[model samples]
Target: MQDILYNLMSTEFENPWKTIRSRPIYDNPWIAVREEDVLKPNGAPGIYGVVSFKNKAIGIVPVDSEGYTYLVGQFRYTLNEYSWEIPEGGGPMNEAPLETAKRELEEETGLHAATWSELGRIHTSNSVTDEEGFLFLATDLTPGPSNPEDTEQLIIKRVSLKDAVAMVMRGEITDSLSIAGLLKAFMIVSSY
Candidate 1:
Protein backbone atom coordinates (compact mmCIF):
# COMPACT_ATOMS: atom_id res chain seq x y z
CA MET A 1 0.00 0.00 0.00
CA GLN A 2 1.17 3.49 -0.80
CA ASP A 3 1.65 5.77 2.18
CA ILE A 4 -0.91 8.57 2.07
CA LEU A 5 1.46 10.98 3.82
CA TYR A 6 4.60 9.82 2.01
CA ASN A 7 5.28 13.25 0.50
CA LEU A 8 3.07 15.41 2.63
CA MET A 9 4.33 18.51 4.43
CA SER A 10 2.10 21.13 5.98
CA THR A 11 2.34 24.51 7.66
CA GLU A 12 -0.03 26.37 9.93
CA PHE A 13 -2.37 28.53 7.90
CA GLU A 14 -3.79 31.81 9.13
CA ASN A 15 -6.21 34.28 7.51
CA PRO A 16 -6.65 31.91 4.60
CA TRP A 17 -10.39 32.40 4.66
CA LYS A 18 -11.70 34.52 1.87
CA THR A 19 -15.17 34.24 0.49
CA ILE A 20 -15.76 34.99 -3.16
CA ARG A 21 -19.30 33.73 -3.01
CA SER A 22 -21.55 31.48 -0.93
CA ARG A 23 -25.05 30.14 -1.37
CA PRO A 24 -27.48 28.13 0.69
CA ILE A 25 -27.26 24.39 0.05
CA TYR A 26 -30.87 23.65 0.80
CA ASP A 27 -34.23 25.33 1.02
CA ASN A 28 -34.81 24.12 4.59
CA PRO A 29 -32.56 26.94 5.80
CA TRP A 30 -29.92 25.18 7.94
CA ILE A 31 -27.87 22.79 5.84
CA ALA A 32 -25.58 22.84 2.85
CA VAL A 33 -23.36 25.58 1.50
CA ARG A 34 -21.83 26.50 -1.80
CA GLU A 35 -18.69 28.20 -0.53
CA GLU A 36 -15.75 29.91 -2.11
CA ASP A 37 -12.40 29.81 -0.31
CA VAL A 38 -9.04 31.43 -0.71
CA LEU A 39 -6.26 29.25 0.61
CA LYS A 40 -2.50 29.46 0.83
CA PRO A 41 -1.30 26.13 -0.46
CA ASN A 42 2.19 25.09 0.69
CA GLY A 43 2.47 28.63 2.01
CA ALA A 44 3.00 29.88 -1.52
CA PRO A 45 0.11 32.25 -2.05
CA GLY A 46 -3.64 32.40 -2.06
CA ILE A 47 -5.87 30.50 -4.50
CA TYR A 48 -9.61 30.47 -4.59
CA GLY A 49 -12.05 27.64 -5.22
CA VAL A 50 -15.69 26.89 -4.58
CA VAL A 51 -17.30 23.72 -3.29
CA SER A 52 -20.49 22.57 -1.63
CA PHE A 53 -21.18 20.61 1.54
CA LYS A 54 -24.18 19.27 3.44
CA ASN A 55 -22.73 20.75 6.61
CA LYS A 56 -19.94 19.25 8.66
CA ALA A 57 -20.39 16.50 11.24
CA ILE A 58 -18.85 13.55 13.04
CA GLY A 59 -19.87 10.00 12.03
CA ILE A 60 -19.67 6.89 14.19
CA VAL A 61 -19.90 3.17 13.65
CA PRO A 62 -21.57 2.29 16.93
CA VAL A 63 -20.67 -1.29 17.86
CA ASP A 64 -22.41 -3.06 20.67
CA SER A 65 -20.93 -5.61 23.07
CA GLU A 66 -22.68 -8.28 21.01
CA GLY A 67 -20.63 -7.23 17.96
CA TYR A 68 -23.55 -5.56 16.21
CA THR A 69 -23.50 -2.21 14.46
CA TYR A 70 -26.10 0.53 14.65
CA LEU A 71 -27.19 2.95 11.96
CA VAL A 72 -29.64 5.81 11.86
CA GLY A 73 -32.16 6.85 9.23
CA GLN A 74 -33.10 10.47 8.84
CA PHE A 75 -34.24 12.90 6.19
CA ARG A 76 -31.29 14.89 4.88
CA TYR A 77 -32.40 18.30 3.76
CA THR A 78 -29.61 18.81 1.25
CA LEU A 79 -30.20 15.49 -0.52
CA ASN A 80 -33.92 15.92 -0.03
CA GLU A 81 -33.94 12.24 0.74
CA TYR A 82 -33.67 9.92 3.69
CA SER A 83 -30.43 8.04 4.24
CA TRP A 84 -29.23 5.28 6.48
CA GLU A 85 -26.02 6.58 7.97
CA ILE A 86 -23.73 5.76 10.83
CA PRO A 87 -24.52 7.52 14.04
CA GLU A 88 -23.81 11.14 13.03
CA GLY A 89 -23.91 14.32 15.06
CA GLY A 90 -22.39 17.78 15.25
CA GLY A 91 -21.70 20.66 17.65
CA PRO A 92 -23.25 23.88 18.84
CA MET A 93 -20.11 25.60 17.58
CA ASN A 94 -16.38 25.01 17.86
CA GLU A 95 -16.92 21.73 19.68
CA ALA A 96 -14.21 19.08 19.73
CA PRO A 97 -14.60 16.16 17.37
CA LEU A 98 -14.47 13.58 20.15
CA GLU A 99 -17.19 15.41 22.02
CA THR A 100 -19.44 15.37 18.99
CA ALA A 101 -18.78 11.69 18.45
CA LYS A 102 -19.79 10.79 21.97
CA ARG A 103 -22.93 12.91 21.86
CA GLU A 104 -23.98 11.76 18.43
CA LEU A 105 -23.51 8.13 19.25
CA GLU A 106 -25.85 8.30 22.17
CA GLU A 107 -28.43 10.51 20.50
CA GLU A 108 -28.68 8.70 17.21
CA THR A 109 -28.29 5.12 18.35
CA GLY A 110 -29.40 5.40 21.95
CA LEU A 111 -26.22 3.54 22.80
CA HIS A 112 -23.18 4.75 24.66
CA ALA A 113 -19.88 3.04 24.64
CA ALA A 114 -17.43 2.68 27.48
CA THR A 115 -14.64 3.05 24.96
CA TRP A 116 -14.22 4.87 21.67
CA SER A 117 -11.37 4.66 19.23
CA GLU A 118 -11.18 7.44 16.72
CA LEU A 119 -10.48 5.95 13.34
CA GLY A 120 -9.58 9.32 11.84
CA ARG A 121 -11.04 12.32 10.05
CA ILE A 122 -12.17 12.66 6.46
CA HIS A 123 -12.76 15.59 4.17
CA THR A 124 -14.54 14.26 1.10
CA SER A 125 -14.62 17.57 -0.78
CA ASN A 126 -12.12 19.90 0.78
CA SER A 127 -11.25 21.85 -2.32
CA VAL A 128 -13.66 24.66 -1.61
CA THR A 129 -15.46 23.93 1.65
CA ASP A 130 -14.13 24.32 5.17
CA GLU A 131 -15.38 21.13 6.75
CA GLU A 132 -13.49 18.21 8.24
CA GLY A 133 -15.52 15.38 9.73
CA PHE A 134 -14.30 12.86 12.29
CA LEU A 135 -14.97 9.13 12.21
CA PHE A 136 -15.06 6.91 15.28
CA LEU A 137 -15.52 3.32 16.50
CA ALA A 138 -17.95 2.77 19.36
CA THR A 139 -17.67 -0.40 21.40
CA ASP A 140 -18.55 -1.68 24.86
CA LEU A 141 -22.01 -0.30 24.32
CA THR A 142 -25.13 -0.30 26.47
CA PRO A 143 -28.49 0.71 25.07
CA GLY A 144 -30.58 3.64 26.27
CA PRO A 145 -33.21 6.01 24.86
CA SER A 146 -32.49 8.01 21.75
CA ASN A 147 -32.35 11.79 22.06
CA PRO A 148 -32.66 13.16 18.59
CA GLU A 149 -33.23 16.84 18.11
CA ASP A 150 -36.72 18.29 17.91
CA THR A 151 -36.54 18.61 14.15
CA GLU A 152 -34.96 15.21 13.83
CA GLN A 153 -37.01 12.16 13.04
CA LEU A 154 -34.68 9.24 13.22
CA ILE A 155 -34.95 5.45 13.25
CA ILE A 156 -32.24 3.31 14.72
CA LYS A 157 -31.43 -0.14 13.38
CA ARG A 158 -28.70 -2.70 13.86
CA VAL A 159 -26.99 -5.09 11.48
CA SER A 160 -24.44 -7.76 12.00
CA LEU A 161 -20.95 -7.10 10.71
CA LYS A 162 -21.56 -9.23 7.66
CA ASP A 163 -24.86 -7.58 6.84
CA ALA A 164 -23.44 -4.12 7.35
CA VAL A 165 -20.80 -4.66 4.72
CA ALA A 166 -23.43 -6.13 2.45
CA MET A 167 -25.54 -3.00 2.84
CA VAL A 168 -22.60 -0.86 1.75
CA MET A 169 -22.08 -3.03 -1.32
CA ARG A 170 -25.80 -2.88 -2.11
CA GLY A 171 -25.78 0.93 -1.86
CA GLU A 172 -28.22 0.73 1.03
CA ILE A 173 -25.80 2.73 3.17
CA THR A 174 -23.96 5.49 1.35
CA ASP A 175 -22.84 7.98 3.95
CA SER A 176 -19.13 8.40 3.40
CA LEU A 177 -18.04 8.70 7.02
CA SER A 178 -19.98 5.64 8.08
CA ILE A 179 -18.61 3.74 5.13
CA ALA A 180 -15.05 4.70 6.02
CA GLY A 181 -15.33 3.56 9.61
CA LEU A 182 -16.97 0.29 8.58
CA LEU A 183 -14.34 -0.47 5.98
CA LYS A 184 -11.55 0.24 8.44
CA ALA A 185 -13.19 -1.85 11.10
CA PHE A 186 -13.74 -4.61 8.56
CA MET A 187 -10.06 -4.63 7.66
CA ILE A 188 -9.14 -5.08 11.31
CA VAL A 189 -11.88 -7.52 12.30
CA SER A 190 -11.75 -9.74 9.23
CA SER A 191 -8.03 -10.27 9.71
CA TYR A 192 -8.69 -12.05 12.96
Candidate 2:
Protein backbone atom coordinates (compact mmCIF):
# COMPACT_ATOMS: atom_id res chain seq x y z
CA MET A 1 0.00 0.00 0.00
CA GLN A 2 2.84 2.37 0.74
CA ASP A 3 4.52 1.71 -2.57
CA ILE A 4 1.23 2.03 -4.41
CA LEU A 5 0.44 5.34 -2.74
CA TYR A 6 3.94 6.62 -3.36
CA ASN A 7 3.78 5.64 -7.04
CA LEU A 8 0.41 7.38 -7.44
CA MET A 9 1.57 10.49 -5.64
CA SER A 10 4.88 10.72 -7.42
CA THR A 11 3.32 10.10 -10.80
CA GLU A 12 0.19 12.19 -10.33
CA PHE A 13 1.98 15.30 -9.08
CA GLU A 14 2.80 17.75 -11.81
CA ASN A 15 2.24 21.47 -12.25
CA PRO A 16 -0.71 22.06 -14.51
CA TRP A 17 -0.51 25.82 -14.45
CA LYS A 18 1.78 27.57 -16.90
CA THR A 19 2.99 31.10 -16.69
CA ILE A 20 2.78 33.08 -19.92
CA ARG A 21 4.46 36.20 -18.56
CA SER A 22 5.15 37.68 -15.16
CA ARG A 23 5.77 41.35 -14.48
CA PRO A 24 6.80 43.15 -11.35
CA ILE A 25 3.87 44.98 -9.78
CA TYR A 26 5.52 46.34 -6.70
CA ASP A 27 8.63 45.90 -4.60
CA ASN A 28 9.90 47.03 -1.23
CA PRO A 29 12.65 45.95 1.12
CA TRP A 30 10.33 43.43 2.74
CA ILE A 31 8.18 42.18 -0.15
CA ALA A 32 7.85 42.04 -3.89
CA VAL A 33 4.59 41.72 -5.79
CA ARG A 34 4.32 40.25 -9.26
CA GLU A 35 1.45 39.98 -11.70
CA GLU A 36 1.51 36.90 -13.87
CA ASP A 37 -0.35 35.93 -16.98
CA VAL A 38 -1.08 32.26 -16.70
CA LEU A 39 -2.85 29.31 -18.23
CA LYS A 40 -5.10 27.70 -15.66
CA PRO A 41 -5.39 23.97 -15.16
CA ASN A 42 -8.36 23.85 -17.51
CA GLY A 43 -6.22 25.56 -20.18
CA ALA A 44 -8.00 28.86 -19.70
CA PRO A 45 -6.20 32.16 -19.50
CA GLY A 46 -6.04 33.92 -16.14
CA ILE A 47 -4.08 36.41 -14.08
CA TYR A 48 -2.43 35.63 -10.79
CA GLY A 49 -0.96 38.13 -8.38
CA VAL A 50 1.66 36.84 -5.99
CA VAL A 51 3.51 38.49 -3.15
CA SER A 52 7.06 37.28 -2.55
CA PHE A 53 8.72 37.88 0.77
CA LYS A 54 12.31 38.98 0.89
CA ASN A 55 12.90 37.26 4.21
CA LYS A 56 11.86 34.21 6.14
CA ALA A 57 9.49 34.88 9.04
CA ILE A 58 11.03 33.44 12.21
CA GLY A 59 9.17 32.81 15.48
CA ILE A 60 10.45 31.56 18.84
CA VAL A 61 8.53 30.04 21.72
CA PRO A 62 10.71 30.44 24.78
CA VAL A 63 9.73 27.86 27.40
CA ASP A 64 11.42 28.45 30.73
CA SER A 65 12.20 25.82 33.37
CA GLU A 66 9.04 26.68 35.35
CA GLY A 67 6.77 25.69 32.43
CA TYR A 68 6.28 29.31 31.51
CA THR A 69 6.51 30.93 28.08
CA TYR A 70 6.90 34.54 26.97
CA LEU A 71 4.70 36.55 24.65
CA VAL A 72 5.30 39.84 22.93
CA GLY A 73 2.57 42.42 22.46
CA GLN A 74 2.80 45.25 19.99
CA PHE A 75 0.61 47.34 17.75
CA ARG A 76 0.67 45.99 14.21
CA TYR A 77 0.59 48.65 11.62
CA THR A 78 -0.91 46.50 8.88
CA LEU A 79 -3.68 45.25 11.16
CA ASN A 80 -4.10 48.57 12.92
CA GLU A 81 -4.52 46.78 16.25
CA TYR A 82 -2.58 45.42 19.17
CA SER A 83 -1.41 41.85 18.70
CA TRP A 84 0.00 39.40 21.19
CA GLU A 85 2.33 36.97 19.50
CA ILE A 86 5.41 34.87 19.98
CA PRO A 87 8.71 36.63 19.49
CA GLU A 88 8.78 36.95 15.71
CA GLY A 89 10.53 38.89 13.00
CA GLY A 90 11.69 38.62 9.43
CA GLY A 91 15.23 37.47 8.69
CA PRO A 92 17.13 37.84 5.47
CA MET A 93 16.90 34.80 3.25
CA ASN A 94 20.67 34.48 3.23
CA GLU A 95 20.82 33.86 7.00
CA ALA A 96 20.07 30.63 8.80
CA PRO A 97 16.55 30.46 10.19
CA LEU A 98 17.68 29.20 13.59
CA GLU A 99 20.11 32.07 14.00
CA THR A 100 17.39 34.46 12.98
CA ALA A 101 15.01 32.91 15.50
CA LYS A 102 17.55 33.32 18.26
CA ARG A 103 18.12 36.95 17.39
CA GLU A 104 14.41 37.69 17.17
CA LEU A 105 13.62 35.99 20.46
CA GLU A 106 16.17 38.07 22.30
CA GLU A 107 15.37 41.29 20.51
CA GLU A 108 11.65 41.24 21.18
CA THR A 109 11.43 39.45 24.50
CA GLY A 110 14.83 39.87 26.21
CA LEU A 111 15.10 36.11 26.66
CA HIS A 112 17.88 33.86 25.47
CA ALA A 113 17.77 30.12 25.23
CA ALA A 114 20.52 27.65 25.94
CA THR A 115 18.90 25.06 23.69
CA TRP A 116 16.88 25.37 20.49
CA SER A 117 14.89 22.95 18.43
CA GLU A 118 12.77 23.40 15.39
CA LEU A 119 9.02 23.14 15.83
CA GLY A 120 8.10 23.33 12.14
CA ARG A 121 7.80 25.48 9.05
CA ILE A 122 4.53 26.93 7.87
CA HIS A 123 3.35 28.91 4.90
CA THR A 124 1.99 32.05 6.51
CA SER A 125 -0.53 32.92 3.76
CA ASN A 126 -0.26 30.55 0.84
CA SER A 127 -3.14 31.94 -1.18
CA VAL A 128 -1.67 35.36 -1.77
CA THR A 129 1.85 35.49 -0.40
CA ASP A 130 4.83 33.20 -0.53
CA GLU A 131 5.85 34.09 2.99
CA GLU A 132 7.31 31.11 4.82
CA GLY A 133 7.48 31.04 8.62
CA PHE A 134 9.96 29.05 10.71
CA LEU A 135 8.98 28.12 14.26
CA PHE A 136 11.31 27.08 17.04
CA LEU A 137 11.18 25.79 20.62
CA ALA A 138 13.63 27.61 22.88
CA THR A 139 14.43 26.10 26.27
CA ASP A 140 16.63 26.92 29.30
CA LEU A 141 15.98 30.59 29.09
CA THR A 142 18.03 33.42 30.67
CA PRO A 143 16.39 36.80 31.05
CA GLY A 144 17.98 40.10 30.02
CA PRO A 145 16.92 43.55 28.90
CA SER A 146 15.21 43.46 25.48
CA ASN A 147 16.49 45.53 22.60
CA PRO A 148 13.51 46.10 20.35
CA GLU A 149 13.68 47.95 17.07
CA ASP A 150 13.19 51.69 17.04
CA THR A 151 9.78 51.29 15.47
CA GLU A 152 8.63 48.76 18.02
CA GLN A 153 6.77 49.54 21.25
CA LEU A 154 6.51 46.13 22.89
CA ILE A 155 5.10 44.63 26.07
CA ILE A 156 6.35 41.34 27.39
CA LYS A 157 4.26 38.87 29.32
CA ARG A 158 5.19 35.58 30.89
CA VAL A 159 2.44 32.98 31.16
CA SER A 160 2.24 29.31 31.86
CA LEU A 161 2.57 27.20 28.73
CA LYS A 162 -0.94 25.89 29.32
CA ASP A 163 -2.32 29.41 29.44
CA ALA A 164 -0.49 30.27 26.25
CA VAL A 165 -2.18 27.39 24.48
CA ALA A 166 -5.49 28.52 25.89
CA MET A 167 -4.91 31.99 24.51
CA VAL A 168 -4.50 30.46 21.08
CA MET A 169 -7.66 28.44 21.46
CA ARG A 170 -9.63 31.47 22.61
CA GLY A 171 -8.47 33.49 19.59
CA GLU A 172 -6.62 35.99 21.75
CA ILE A 173 -3.61 35.23 19.60
CA THR A 174 -4.36 35.74 15.93
CA ASP A 175 -0.91 35.90 14.41
CA SER A 176 -0.26 32.84 12.29
CA LEU A 177 3.33 32.19 13.43
CA SER A 178 2.34 32.48 17.09
CA ILE A 179 -0.58 30.12 16.65
CA ALA A 180 1.55 27.56 14.85
CA GLY A 181 4.48 27.82 17.26
CA LEU A 182 2.40 27.72 20.42
CA LEU A 183 0.32 24.75 19.30
CA LYS A 184 3.36 22.78 18.20
CA ALA A 185 5.19 23.62 21.41
CA PHE A 186 2.18 22.59 23.46
CA MET A 187 2.02 19.19 21.81
CA ILE A 188 5.75 18.61 22.30
CA VAL A 189 5.70 19.82 25.89
CA SER A 190 2.69 17.65 26.67
CA SER A 191 4.59 14.56 25.58
CA TYR A 192 7.41 15.19 28.04
Candidate 3:
Protein backbone atom coordinates (compact mmCIF):
# COMPACT_ATOMS: atom_id res chain seq x y z
CA MET A 1 0.00 0.00 0.00
CA GLN A 2 2.82 2.39 0.89
CA ASP A 3 4.67 1.57 -2.32
CA ILE A 4 1.53 2.06 -4.38
CA LEU A 5 0.84 5.35 -2.65
CA TYR A 6 4.42 6.48 -3.16
CA ASN A 7 4.34 5.52 -6.82
CA LEU A 8 1.09 7.38 -7.32
CA MET A 9 2.45 10.44 -5.54
CA SER A 10 5.66 10.43 -7.57
CA THR A 11 3.96 9.90 -10.91
CA GLU A 12 4.28 12.78 -13.36
CA PHE A 13 1.49 13.16 -15.89
CA GLU A 14 1.85 14.96 -19.22
CA ASN A 15 -0.78 16.91 -21.11
CA PRO A 16 -2.93 14.46 -23.04
CA TRP A 17 -4.83 16.83 -25.31
CA LYS A 18 -3.03 18.41 -28.25
CA THR A 19 -4.30 21.55 -29.92
CA ILE A 20 -4.03 21.82 -33.69
CA ARG A 21 -5.80 25.08 -34.47
CA SER A 22 -7.57 27.70 -32.39
CA ARG A 23 -9.69 30.76 -33.07
CA PRO A 24 -11.72 33.20 -31.08
CA ILE A 25 -15.44 32.50 -31.14
CA TYR A 26 -16.56 35.52 -29.15
CA ASP A 27 -15.19 38.25 -26.91
CA ASN A 28 -16.53 40.71 -24.35
CA PRO A 29 -15.13 42.85 -21.58
CA TRP A 30 -15.62 40.09 -19.02
CA ILE A 31 -14.94 36.91 -21.01
CA ALA A 32 -13.53 35.62 -24.26
CA VAL A 33 -14.63 32.38 -25.92
CA ARG A 34 -12.31 30.40 -28.12
CA GLU A 35 -12.74 27.18 -30.07
CA GLU A 36 -9.85 24.81 -30.54
CA ASP A 37 -9.25 21.87 -32.82
CA VAL A 38 -7.62 19.24 -30.72
CA LEU A 39 -6.61 15.61 -30.36
CA LYS A 40 -8.13 14.02 -27.32
CA PRO A 41 -6.38 11.92 -24.74
CA ASN A 42 -7.33 8.83 -26.71
CA GLY A 43 -5.79 10.46 -29.79
CA ALA A 44 -9.18 11.11 -31.30
CA PRO A 45 -9.67 14.43 -33.07
CA GLY A 46 -12.20 16.80 -31.55
CA ILE A 47 -13.13 20.40 -30.97
CA TYR A 48 -13.02 22.08 -27.60
CA GLY A 49 -14.59 25.37 -26.61
CA VAL A 50 -13.08 27.32 -23.76
CA VAL A 51 -14.21 30.51 -22.04
CA SER A 52 -11.38 32.59 -20.67
CA PHE A 53 -12.03 35.05 -17.89
CA LYS A 54 -10.44 38.47 -17.69
CA ASN A 55 -10.31 38.30 -13.90
CA LYS A 56 -10.08 35.92 -11.01
CA ALA A 57 -13.19 35.44 -8.88
CA ILE A 58 -12.94 36.42 -5.23
CA GLY A 59 -15.44 35.35 -2.54
CA ILE A 60 -15.61 36.45 1.06
CA VAL A 61 -17.57 35.06 4.00
CA PRO A 62 -17.82 37.83 6.59
CA VAL A 63 -18.61 36.53 10.06
CA ASP A 64 -19.08 38.85 12.98
CA SER A 65 -18.33 38.21 16.63
CA GLU A 66 -21.69 36.61 17.35
CA GLY A 67 -20.99 33.96 14.71
CA TYR A 68 -23.24 35.69 12.21
CA THR A 69 -22.33 35.92 8.54
CA TYR A 70 -23.68 38.18 5.80
CA LEU A 71 -25.32 37.09 2.58
CA VAL A 72 -25.90 39.21 -0.49
CA GLY A 73 -29.14 38.81 -2.40
CA GLN A 74 -29.33 39.81 -6.02
CA PHE A 75 -31.04 38.83 -9.23
CA ARG A 76 -28.52 37.07 -11.39
CA TYR A 77 -29.10 38.01 -14.99
CA THR A 78 -27.51 34.94 -16.51
CA LEU A 79 -29.26 32.54 -14.17
CA ASN A 80 -32.50 34.48 -14.58
CA GLU A 81 -33.26 33.96 -10.93
CA TYR A 82 -32.81 35.45 -7.52
CA SER A 83 -29.63 34.24 -5.85
CA TRP A 84 -28.31 34.52 -2.32
CA GLU A 85 -24.58 34.36 -1.98
CA ILE A 86 -21.60 35.48 0.02
CA PRO A 87 -19.98 38.74 -0.94
CA GLU A 88 -18.13 38.02 -4.17
CA GLY A 89 -16.80 39.72 -7.26
CA GLY A 90 -14.15 39.51 -9.93
CA GLY A 91 -10.62 40.77 -9.32
CA PRO A 92 -8.25 41.57 -12.11
CA MET A 93 -5.44 39.12 -12.73
CA ASN A 94 -2.80 41.60 -11.63
CA GLU A 95 -4.43 42.36 -8.26
CA ALA A 96 -4.02 40.35 -5.08
CA PRO A 97 -7.07 38.22 -4.36
CA LEU A 98 -7.16 39.37 -0.74
CA GLU A 99 -7.53 42.97 -1.79
CA THR A 100 -10.34 41.98 -4.10
CA ALA A 101 -12.02 40.01 -1.37
CA LYS A 102 -11.87 42.98 0.97
CA ARG A 103 -13.23 45.29 -1.68
CA GLU A 104 -16.07 42.93 -2.58
CA LEU A 105 -17.06 42.42 1.04
CA GLU A 106 -17.22 46.12 1.63
CA GLU A 107 -18.92 46.92 -1.64
CA GLU A 108 -21.64 44.35 -1.26
CA THR A 109 -22.21 44.38 2.49
CA GLY A 110 -20.36 47.43 3.79
CA LEU A 111 -18.39 45.24 6.15
CA HIS A 112 -14.64 45.38 6.66
CA ALA A 113 -12.67 42.76 8.44
CA ALA A 114 -9.80 43.13 10.83
CA THR A 115 -8.95 39.48 10.45
CA TRP A 116 -8.87 37.55 7.22
CA SER A 117 -7.85 33.97 6.49
CA GLU A 118 -7.88 32.05 3.23
CA LEU A 119 -10.58 29.43 3.09
CA GLY A 120 -9.57 27.74 -0.16
CA ARG A 121 -9.39 28.16 -3.93
CA ILE A 122 -11.69 26.61 -6.51
CA HIS A 123 -11.95 26.27 -10.26
CA THR A 124 -15.41 27.76 -10.98
CA SER A 125 -16.01 25.60 -14.04
CA ASN A 126 -13.02 23.65 -15.22
CA SER A 127 -14.75 21.74 -18.01
CA VAL A 128 -15.47 24.87 -20.05
CA THR A 129 -14.19 28.02 -18.37
CA ASP A 130 -10.76 28.99 -17.16
CA GLU A 131 -12.18 30.87 -14.17
CA GLU A 132 -10.48 30.46 -10.83
CA GLY A 133 -11.96 31.59 -7.50
CA PHE A 134 -10.29 32.58 -4.24
CA LEU A 135 -12.26 32.07 -1.03
CA PHE A 136 -11.61 33.86 2.23
CA LEU A 137 -13.08 33.94 5.74
CA ALA A 138 -13.39 37.50 7.04
CA THR A 139 -13.85 38.06 10.76
CA ASP A 140 -13.72 40.89 13.30
CA LEU A 141 -15.97 42.86 11.03
CA THR A 142 -16.83 46.56 11.16
CA PRO A 143 -19.95 47.68 9.39
CA GLY A 144 -20.50 50.88 7.40
CA PRO A 145 -22.44 52.05 4.36
CA SER A 146 -22.14 50.00 1.20
CA ASN A 147 -21.05 51.38 -2.13
CA PRO A 148 -22.28 48.88 -4.67
CA GLU A 149 -21.65 49.23 -8.36
CA ASP A 150 -24.29 50.72 -10.65
CA THR A 151 -25.07 47.31 -12.05
CA GLU A 152 -25.80 45.82 -8.64
CA GLN A 153 -29.10 46.13 -6.82
CA LEU A 154 -28.24 44.07 -3.78
CA ILE A 155 -30.07 43.09 -0.62
CA ILE A 156 -28.01 42.13 2.38
CA LYS A 157 -28.99 39.73 5.13
CA ARG A 158 -27.20 38.76 8.30
CA VAL A 159 -27.58 35.19 9.49
CA SER A 160 -25.88 32.91 11.90
CA LEU A 161 -23.09 30.81 10.49
CA LYS A 162 -25.06 27.68 11.36
CA ASP A 163 -28.04 29.03 9.47
CA ALA A 164 -25.82 29.77 6.50
CA VAL A 165 -24.61 26.20 6.51
CA ALA A 166 -28.21 25.04 6.71
CA MET A 167 -28.99 27.15 3.67
CA VAL A 168 -26.24 25.36 1.78
CA MET A 169 -27.55 21.94 2.83
CA ARG A 170 -31.08 22.90 1.90
CA GLY A 171 -29.96 24.19 -1.49
CA GLU A 172 -31.18 27.71 -0.77
CA ILE A 173 -27.69 28.95 -1.46
CA THR A 174 -26.90 27.85 -5.00
CA ASP A 175 -24.00 30.01 -6.02
CA SER A 176 -20.92 27.87 -6.48
CA LEU A 177 -18.63 30.20 -4.60
CA SER A 178 -21.12 30.67 -1.76
CA ILE A 179 -21.69 26.98 -1.29
CA ALA A 180 -18.00 26.21 -1.26
CA GLY A 181 -17.07 29.17 0.89
CA LEU A 182 -19.89 28.72 3.44
CA LEU A 183 -19.28 25.01 3.91
CA LYS A 184 -15.56 25.58 4.26
CA ALA A 185 -16.08 28.40 6.75
CA PHE A 186 -18.52 26.28 8.72
CA MET A 187 -16.05 23.45 8.95
CA ILE A 188 -13.26 25.76 10.02
CA VAL A 189 -15.40 27.60 12.58
CA SER A 190 -16.83 24.38 14.00
CA SER A 191 -13.43 22.83 14.47
CA TYR A 192 -12.52 25.62 16.85
Give the whole-model CA lDDT for all candidates, comma-separated. Answer: 0.73, 0.95, 0.96
On a 0 to 100 scale, what is the lDDT of residue 60 in model 3?
95
Estimate TM-scores for all models.
0.73, 0.94, 0.95
- Per residue, candidate 3 scores C-alpha lDDT tens digits across 162-190 of 99999999999999999999999999998
What are the root-mean-square deviations of the candidates from the true structure over C-alphas? 5.3, 1.9, 1.5
Candidate 3 clash pair list: none
Best by TM-score: 3
lDDT of 2 by residue, 1-192 (tens): 999988887885779999999999999998999999999999999999999999999999999999999999999999999999999999999999999998998899888899999999999999899999999999999988899999999999999999999999999999999999999999999999
- Go through the candidates in order and give the clash count of each: 0, 0, 0
Task: Enumerate residue pairs that collide in model 2.
Answer: none
Report the lDDT of model 2 for residue 140: 93
Residue 19, model 2, lDDT: 100
